[model samples]
Target: MFRQSLPAGIGRMMASMLGDSPPSSRQGADAFPSSQSFHTTATLAAIPDPYKVLGVDRNASAGDIKKAYYGLAKKYHPDTNKDPNAKEKFAEAQSAYELLSDAKKRETYDRFGSAAFDQNGGFDPNAAAGGNPFAGAGGFHGFGGGFPGGFAADINFEDLFGAFTGGARRAGRGRRGPFQEVLVGEDIEVQTNISFMEAAKGTSKDVVITPLTECGTCKGDGLKAGAKRSQCRQCNGSGTRVHFMQGGFQVAATCDACGGAGMIVPRGSECGTCRGNGVVRDKKTITVDIPGGVEDGMRLRVAGEGDAPPTGTQAAPGTRTQRGDLYVSIRVAPDHRFSRSGSDILYTASIPLTTALLGGEVTIPTLDGEVKVKVATGTGTGDRITLSGMGMKKLGGRSRGYTPTGDLKVEFKVAMPKYLTANQRTILEVLADEMNDKTARRTMNIGKDSPPSEAGNAPTDSQKNEGFLKSAWHKLMNATKNGDGGNSASNPSKKESDDAKKSDKESK
Candidate 1:
C-alpha cells in the first residue's frame, strides 16, 4: 500500500502544478499516511567512505576523480578481467565515483558524513513537506533519523534535481535518464605471420573478426514497440537494496529485481531481435596495412574498430559513442639464405679456392637480383663485401619520394678442390719447391731428398738386422713343426740361410 501511494501523490502534485487546485487538507494527509514498518532503521556506520573506496584524497579534483575511476574500471570490469572480486571492486569504484563526482553530493557528504542522504530514520515526508523534517533529530545530528526541514513547499525537488537523477514527476513521453555507469566496449586482438620479404616491404592482409554489434531491429534500445520501464519496487529506484546480517551489520547490494539498473521492464516487453541484449554477433573482414621495416613481435593499433558500448550507457546528452580499439600482432618468418640485423641484411657466398687467390668475378644473390661483384686480388675466406643501398627498404619510404635502404653484407667462403690429377700434383709440387714450402715437402711423398734437420727417410741398421733374424727363425720352426720329410725341411732352411747371408753382405 505504501509503494502504491507514492506515485499517486506525485501525480496529484503534478496535476496541481498544471493549473488544478491543490488537494484538500484531508486528502493530502490521507495521501501520505505514516507507515512505521516501511521506514528504514539502518544507520550510516556500515557505508564505506567514498574517498577511501576510490583510493583518492579528501580534496581530489573532479578530473582526478574521473581518471581514478577509469583506471579502476579497466582493471575490474567484468568484460576485461575475470577476477573473483572484480565485480565487487568495480561496484565499489562506481559507487565512490557517483558520490565524489557530484558537487552538491560531495559537499553535503563532506559536511554530514553520509547521514544527509539517510532516507528513513525519523523522516516524515508529510511533516517535511512544509516544515523541518529534522527538528526532532536535534539539528541534523547523526541523521539519527532524517534531514531537518527537508525543503519548503515552494521549492520543487524534481525541477532542481532533474539533472542528477531520474525525475519521476517530470512530464516526458518516454523514460530517458542519466545512467549510473557508462562502460567502454571490449577490445580485440589478433595475430598474423608474414614472410621475411613481406616484412621488409609493406604488405596488406585481410583479417576476419567476429564481434558484437548493435541490433538494428530494435535500434539497440532493447525494448519492444510502445514499451515502458518503471522504477523497481524492491529498491525504491535506488539501484541497491539493504541486506541485514548478523551482529547488527548492514550491507547494501545491487537489487536483483532490476539487475542494479533501478528500473524494470514490464512482462514480455523485451525486444525479440537481440533477446533484450541490444547486440548481436557479426563477422567482418578488415584490411590491415603493414609497414615496411617493421620488426617481429610488433603490434599495430586500429582505432574505433571494436565492439560498441550499450545504448543505455552514455556520459551525457549529445556525447559521442565510444568503441574499443583493434590490436594486430605481427610475426615475421625467417628467410632461408638471408638474415637480418636492424636494417641490414647478411648473406654468405661460397667462392672457389682459385677465385679467392686470383681476382675474379662472382655472381651473388641480393634483394633486387643477382649482381656480379669483383673479388679483390688475394681475397681470403671469411672476408666481408658490403653492397650499399641494396638491402631492405626503410619503413615509411614510400611517402618520402626516395627510399632509404640498408646495406647487404656478403661473407666469402673459400671452397677447396677434393681431388687432383698427376699433372696438377707435379705442377703444385714444383711450385711448392720454388716457394720453399716446408709443410708441403713434409706432407707429400715426392721422390726427392728432403731438407736436413728433418727426420731421416730410411730405417737404422738395428731395424734391418731384427727383420732378417725373425724371417730365418720363423722358416726353420714352420718346416720342423709341419712333420714334412727330410727334403721339405732341409729345402726351407737352406733358402732362409741364403737370404740371411745376403742381408749380412749388404750391411757390410
Candidate 2:
C-alpha cells in the first residue's frame, strides 16, 4: 500500500480533552485584565494519540482501530500519501473517533447506532467497509488474511497532526486575549405588512422598532459605584491556577475565587442601581426602513434593534443590548380585482357585446387610477390590449420599456345577458339572422379551455352553428303566435330566471 506522513496532534480541540470545562453557570466569568502569549511551543507540544482524537475513555481505547485508520489515511492524505483510498480511510477514522470520544455520542454507539449519522439512525464506522482491490475471487488476500478493512499498518504522523488541530495557526485563535464577556447581540422580532400595490410597484416605507442598548453608568463594569480592585489572596495576583495534563502539556485558566481578574471587588463597589458593570436592559425605539418590490412572505431585515446585555456576564464579560435587527415579514392583502404573481398583477374585466363588436372606450382600472382605453372598432373578444409601463415596478432598474412592462391579456368571456327584454329580443333576432352563427359561435371559445369537469362541456360545432339560425326561427314563430319576438336581449333569459328565483326562495 502507498504511504505518507502526518504531523501529530492538530485540529483537535485540545481543551475539550484534558482541560476543565468552563464554569457550570450559563453566564460566563469576569474578564481577565491581561493576557500573555498562549501559543504552544515545541516544549509544550504533545504526541498524537487516537484517544485524544476520539475524546474517549482512555482505558477503553484500542490500538487496532487507530492503526487501521492511520494506515488508510496515510496512504491517501495527498501531502505524503499517493494511494487514492488513503484520504477516504483517514476521514473514516476521524469520524469514528469523533463519535467514540464524545461521552454522549459514544453511549449512542453502544446501542443500535449507525454510520448514517445524518439519518438519525446511528453513527457507525464499519457499516460499509473497504476491500483490498488486489484480493482474489473470495476477496481474500495472499497476506494470510481476508480484505475485510484492507487497511495497511503504516501511520502518518504529519497527517494526523495537521488534520486533528488545523496546525498551530488556527490553534492561536482559541487562546485567550484580554478576557472579555460572552458578548451576545440582542435578539428581536416584529410584525409588519406591505400593500399589494406597494409590493408590486416597489416602494420604501419606515417602520418603528424597539431594541436594547447598553447602560452608560457602569460602562459594562459589573462593580459598584465606588468599588476598586482588591488583590486575591489565593494564587496571589495571578488570577488562575496552572496545571500539567495529558503527560507534560500544561493548562492555565482563570481563578475560581476572584472569577479571573486576579483581584476581587469589595461588596460596596457594586453599582447601587445596575450593581456595578454598568450595562442594563432597556428598550429603545428606532425607525427601520423597508424596501419595495418584495413578495408576500418575504422578509425585510433591519439590523441592530434588540435587547441590551447586563454588562457583567461571563469570564470574558457581558454588555447590554446594543442593537438587534428587525425582520419585517411582507404580507400583501389580496386585492379583490387583482392577483399577484411575483411582481405582476392580474384581474378580469368585462365589456358589452356592442363594445366588443362596434368598438368604444371602456374604463380600465389601473393600480394608479382608472383610465379609458379605446376598444378599436371591430375588435374581437380575446384581443389583448397592453398598457406599457403599467405593470409592476422593476427591482433594480428604472429605464427600459415594452418587454419590461406587464402585458394585460383581455380574454373575452362573451356574456350574453342576465335577462332579456321584449324589445331587445326583437333586435337580437334581426342581428342573428344577419350574421348567422359566424363570429358569435367562434367567440364562445369554450373548446380550448379545459376538460368538461373543469369548465363544463363545450358547445358542439353543429350546436354552435344552429344558435343564430334557431334564434331567427324562434322570432318568426313568436311573431306568428300572437306575441312579438322583442324580448331576445331584454327579457328573462333561456336560463329561466323565474326558476332561479324560485330555487333561491326555496333554499332560504
TM-score of each: 0.50, 0.44
Best by TM-score: 1
Candidate 2's TM-score reads 0.44
| Poorest lDDT segment (10 consecutive residues) of candidate 1 | 138-147
Expressed as tens digits, the lDDT of each residue in 204-322 for candidate 1 is 98888877788788766566788766667987876556555452223455466665456666567877776665567789988999988887998877766788755432212232345
In terms of lDDT, model 2 sits at 0.47
RMSD of each: 20.2, 23.6
